[model samples]
Target: MHQQDNGKAETFDVAVIGAGVVGCAIARTYALAGARVVMLEKAADILDGASKGNSAILHTGFDAPPGSVEAACVTAGYREYLEIREKLGLPVMRTGALVIAWTEEQEAILPDLIAQAHANGVTDVEMLSREDTLRREPGLAPSLRASFRVPGEFIIDPWSAPLAYLGQAMAHGAELRRSCKVLGGDFGGTHWDLKLSDGSVRAGLVINAAGLYGDDVDLALIGRRDFTVRPRKGQFVVFDKSAAALAGHILLPVPTKITKGIVVCPTAYGNLLVGPTAEDQTEKDVADLVPDTLAALRARGEEILPGLKDHDVTAIYAGLRPATEEKDYRIRHHADQNYVTVGGIRSTGLTSALGTASYVFGLTEQTGFHYDPPESVHWPTVRNISEAQQRDWERPGNGGVVCQCELVTRREIESALEGPLAARSLAGLKRRTRVTMGRCQGFHCTARLAEMTEGHFAVPMAEATGHD
Candidate 1:
């Protein structure tokens, strides 16, 4: 492991701040292209912020504004994620999507959406009448006036995507430091010197993919404030797996300019999701769940899918998006400063992650950074062990099942405990193995899980409850 635990100063060819999906993709791509890289995160683990929350939908750019960065990145990233999902053996549910209009006002927007879809390079969208829409999604409101079928959209395992990128990056010699916040930085003409919470690092090139804190990091690096990340709080509700059958495909509402609107979709893990009430806030670091917001989401969900609110609510959570004043992403390259800032990557960031990485790499090249492919490098996969691949050390030999709700076995927990970027917190283990992420939501499993990580995190059982 190249992780610097002693908080000593270091140097690298490339340094990426933030370990969200986009940051991981940037670091991983740089490493794959043979640049020494390091990924820094303020949180205890990657994918711990908005990257893991929000609607985990892989958009096809069907409704993105024409000629926008989001449109291009989403259109390209959706395709790339599909290919990479298969290559990494990650879980992805290609449930397609239905953008339905239930009111006359909303019905009037279908043509424009279709036009936007075509403009964004997505030609697979099809228009459907009320009858056809109901036939496709019987649970949807019978008042549906029309629908647009986007066949390319999918529901992906959000947790594993970042892990795959970071895993490959680490295997290719990139280092990852958790809980390492960038306090400040200075451009030294030849290189950039960054002061971390524990130590410092000197890098030839710096890329800021910091999610909610991008604005703060940008100020530290460039000493200018071109944009501010408005924390848009979005709350969601998850229904038990039993409700998954109610929605065949991801059911979306006709989006408006301000938000994508609440959606009801089936997750890759077999649970139905309804949510994401978009409410922009003045606070930049918001993570609280407003009970009223969740209630309103349920009410809206009932209208989208008849009887949807009746389903047993499994969990409810909120995520803060990094929205900015500009409608487009705040990606810029400073050749003189040897820096790139990737900011304002709001809701579509998950779908646009890989494509954004490619774009950022191009920006880096413009700053005189060169990339050359290595002969061979290791790539890690978190594909759950199949019955056929299970080893004695992975199963009954290690211990017994720890989290039965998610079917997370003892071997999985052990693997997380001992793996690279080892699980040092309950949240870390949850992101890695999906433990404590079921209907019970750790009520039945936290005790055992805490014991397993006691030595690793040195925390008590009560304090080991998973963090948001």
Candidate 2:
């Protein structure tokens, strides 16, 4: 968090651009290796980009093409996620995936998918009969021909992962700068001089995990384009928690080469999620919820879960993935420039974040950076406090309740505001404390949260409400 003053430049051993899940994980990895690391984020908070919105399904790499970086990283990352779940209090659900075959053509693809799963080191995948599939998922279409079950796939709280990693990194002396966009940077023979929005940063080495705008940063820094990041917009609809039972697993349609297809899955927070209509967008196309698309998704959901027709829609939003021309991830080390570009992460970025960070570290090590092991560090546990724990904090003035729908208390929201990775806006607070993100979607709690934030942080109402 140190900024240069009096024309004296502050330097670091490693500077990671983009505070997404991957970037935060890279920062934490570098910090654990005892490097003086600094994470620069363009947004006001972490997970504000593609990392903020996703299907939240931690892939098993079973369907991934073998021998690719994604395949390898996803396999390793799922294991890392299991370990991470033990340390952090984030909601990590081990809900396995069910790839349903509604048509004979889809049924025919199941064996090949099983083969791919085996090739990707996922041996627990099984093809189930239509009767067994119906037995497992009663709400599924009776037209089910067959299904492939992958037991390792899971769902997670996407926001909590990066926040926990960043919190731990910050606690271990890795600096984080919010709203600090890297406009450009120059690499000398021995170091890099980055021109941030506010000021300049000098670093011995740099890692670019700048998700969607990754290509822009790569071209600006390395002076070449190995790939271009085309934003693939995925629109999703979340049903009320009462309809969570519609899909007991990550119910997916058989994959097409173009997309994973629409999926009906349950969130770790007890809600059914559907759609994610994969419509690739041009550079100028913004990520917005298409009502027609949402309607189509709802219709598809009804086909997958007949009960969905009765359930209420809770939320609708869209996220853009940094899709590239290359089938695999575009991770390369510029040894001479003392830089590594981590780009084209796409859908599996969150699932493979830890493995990707480890790979980036290995690349940095190959470039001559070394790590000295630390004994221990404080890893912050950031998640929803239980009702019992909430009661404990009620005696203090911070215990007043706020979001009745989500049961968020004033104490929890304030903690998010005061934490190391403090919320800078309503959206930030929503990700941090789950306030105003429930069924009401801030209809009841936004004004209260905004007022408290404005008064406490001394910010204007617009800024507090995340209007700008």
Model 1 residue runs over 4 Å out of place are 1-8, 385-399, 458-461, 464-466
How many Å off is the CA of 340 in candidate 1?
A: 0.6
The Cα local distance difference test for each model comes to 0.82, 0.82
Candidate 1, residues 272-351, lDDT tens digits: the string is 88878888888866678888878888888888877776788888888889889987888888878898889999899988
TM of each candidate vs. truth: 0.94, 0.94
lDDT of 2 by residue, 1-468 (tens): 244535655888899999989998899888988888899998877787888778888998888879999888888878887887657665667779999998888888889999999999899998899999999989887977999899988888788788888887888889889889998888879878999998888889999999898888988888887898888899999898889877779998888776888989987666788978888877523687789999999999998888898999988888888889986899999898999999999888889998998888888798699866568866677754422123323456657779887677787887888856788766777787777667988888877876788744435555543431
TM-score of 2: 0.94
